[model samples]
Target: MAISFYKYQGTGNDFVMVDNRKLAFPASDESFIKRLCDRRIGIGADGLILLQDHADYDFEMVYFNADGRLGSMCGNGARCTVRFARALGVIEDVACFLAADGEHQASVERDLIQLKMNEVKGVEQIGEDYFLNTGSPHYIRFVDDVENLDVYEEGRAIRYNDRFKAEGTNVNFVQRLSDSEVFVRTYERGVEDETLSCGTGVTAAALVAGMLGMQSPIKVKTLGGNLEVAFEQVDEGFKSIYLIGPAKQVFTGSVSL
Candidate 1:
């Protein structure tokens, strides 16, 4: 069988997207997904996204890590998936879809996607760092120099630490450029490496920065590009959180399976 796929990227977090409305692709094929995500052998992407029909939403977003594991809600993947849904005519300027985390809303203005993310109840301060879940579990640590830090080595150490040994957590190293701006780098668990950008990771970083007295409309600079995170502080925690960034389609092709 030949499956047609689209490539999409949001701040360099690329994904191989599939229009699975007909349920053509067998999502249970883990090995096949892993092989397809292999950089040298098949279509290289940080992850794979399947846009499927939903009962009460524009579509259902099914995401998988490069290692072929079902992953949590990916902020970047959700943004890219919205763009993919639009390209397929499943949606127009606005979208309401169900993701692994929960239901989400988004609006597209050209290449920029503003996705409503999950609300954060609270953040656990572990020593000098903070841990939280913004659609995905993340450990955020501030750094002095984000550009020169060894993200892979340091992130791997914390990711595999005994505290998060059972279910690993994505790690984010953040450096503040200003009161309202920051530079961030992430080591995603599923990809198991340092990626150019991570939506949820940066969102967590921005929210943490805000909790620490940073202003709203936090500007986050990732290796791939720039993203903006805005939120409203509520009595319990935070609400009306949005992750805004660019999601661009790279190409389209068919691969034999």
Candidate 2:
């Protein structure tokens, strides 16, 4: 069977999105999905997402990492999924969708998307590093010399360490350029390497700094481009956090898998 797909990108983290509301796609096919995400062999993307019908929410977002493993919520994927939902008439201008983590509120404006991430209770400090879950797991650590650090090697080591050996985690090396402005570099798990940008990783990094008392409305600069993270911390935890930026549609075409 042939499946129709669309291509979308949030920053440089790209994805292949499919409309599965008909439930015709075989989401359980690991090798099939993996082959679709292969850059050299098939349709190139950092991951794949399926938009399915939901009972309560606007739609359901089923995500798979590049490795073809069913993964947790992806911020960028969620954003693009919102756009796909809109294009498919699954949602209106604004709507809520269910992800692996939970329900999320989203909106679309042209190519830009604003996605509401998961609630963060607080940031756990381990020495100078911080850990938090922004939909997906991320380890945010600040380094004095961001320019000199070998991000791929260092992040790979941390990701594969015993702390997260079984299922590796994404690692973000952050450098505070200012109280509200920061630079972020992330080593993503599914990609198994450095990505131009990671929405959840940067969100965790900035919010971890905020929980550490940086400031609200943190500006994070990633290798791909600049993004802004805004939120308010309540007694229960940090709520009303919005991951705002452009989720560009790089290009679209057909490819065999």
Candidate 3:
């Protein structure tokens, strides 16, 4: 069978998108999904996203990592899915969708998407580094020179370390440029590599910045592009967190299954 798919990207983190509202795709085939995300002979993406029908929301976002395993909530994927929903006339400018992490709200304007993330109750301090979950688990480390760092090597070390090796964690190195700006690079767990950018990782970094006394609406610089994270600090947690960035459809094509 042949399946039609859409390619979308948000800050260089690309995904293969499928409109599976009618349940046409074989979502249970992990190896097939892995092959579809292969760089050499497949669609070549960091992940795959399925936009399916949801009774309670605009749509349901089903995400899988490049490795073909069911992944946790993906912020960038959710943003791109929101745009896809709009293109499919499933939603207008505003939308509410169901994801692995639960319900999320979003607004789309042209190519820019503003996605609301879940509230974080607390941040755990592991030595000098910080760990938090912004719809996904992330380890945030403050660094001096982020641009010159070997993200792959260092991030791999931390990700595979004794403490986090079992259930992998996304690693992020953050360099604060100013009180309101930061540069971040991430090693995502599912992809198991240093991606151009990571939405959940960026959100984790921004919330850590808030904990360090930086204000809200932090500007984030990544290898792919720029993104913004805005939030309101509440009692011992954060609320109204939004990850703002651009998600664009690259192309559409049909592939044999």
User: Cα-based RMSD of the predictions, in order?
Assistant: 0.6, 1.6, 0.7
Predicted candidate 3 versus true structure: per-residue lDDT over 1-257, tens digit per residue:
99999999999999999999989999999999999999998999999999999899889999999999999999889889998999999999999989999999999877689999999999999999999999889999999999999999999999999999999999999999998999999999989999999999999999999989999999999999999999999988999999999999999999898
lDDT of each: 0.95, 0.86, 0.95
TM-scores, in order shown? 0.99, 0.94, 0.98
The segments of candidate 1 whose C-alpha lies over 4 angstroms from its true place after superposition are: none
lDDT, model 1, position 244: 99
Scored by Cα lDDT, where does model 1 land? Answer: 0.95
Clashes found in each candidate (C-alpha, N, C closer than 3 A) = 0, 0, 0
Residue 26 lDDT in candidate 3: 95
- State the lDDT of candidate 1 residue by residue for 1-257, as single tens digits: 89999999999999999999999998999888998888999899999999999999999999999999899999999999999999899999999999999999999998799999988998999999999999899999999999999999999999999998689999999999997899999999988999999999999999999999998999999999999999997767789999999999999999998
lDDT of 3 at 95: 98
User: Compared to the true structure, candidate 3 yields what TM-score?
Assistant: 0.98
Report how far off residue 86 is in candidate 1 (Å): 0.7
What clash count does candidate 1 reach?
Answer: 0
Local error of candidate 3 at 124, Å? Answer: 0.4
lDDT (Cα) of model 3: 0.95
Q: Give candidate 3 regions above 4 Å deviation.
A: none
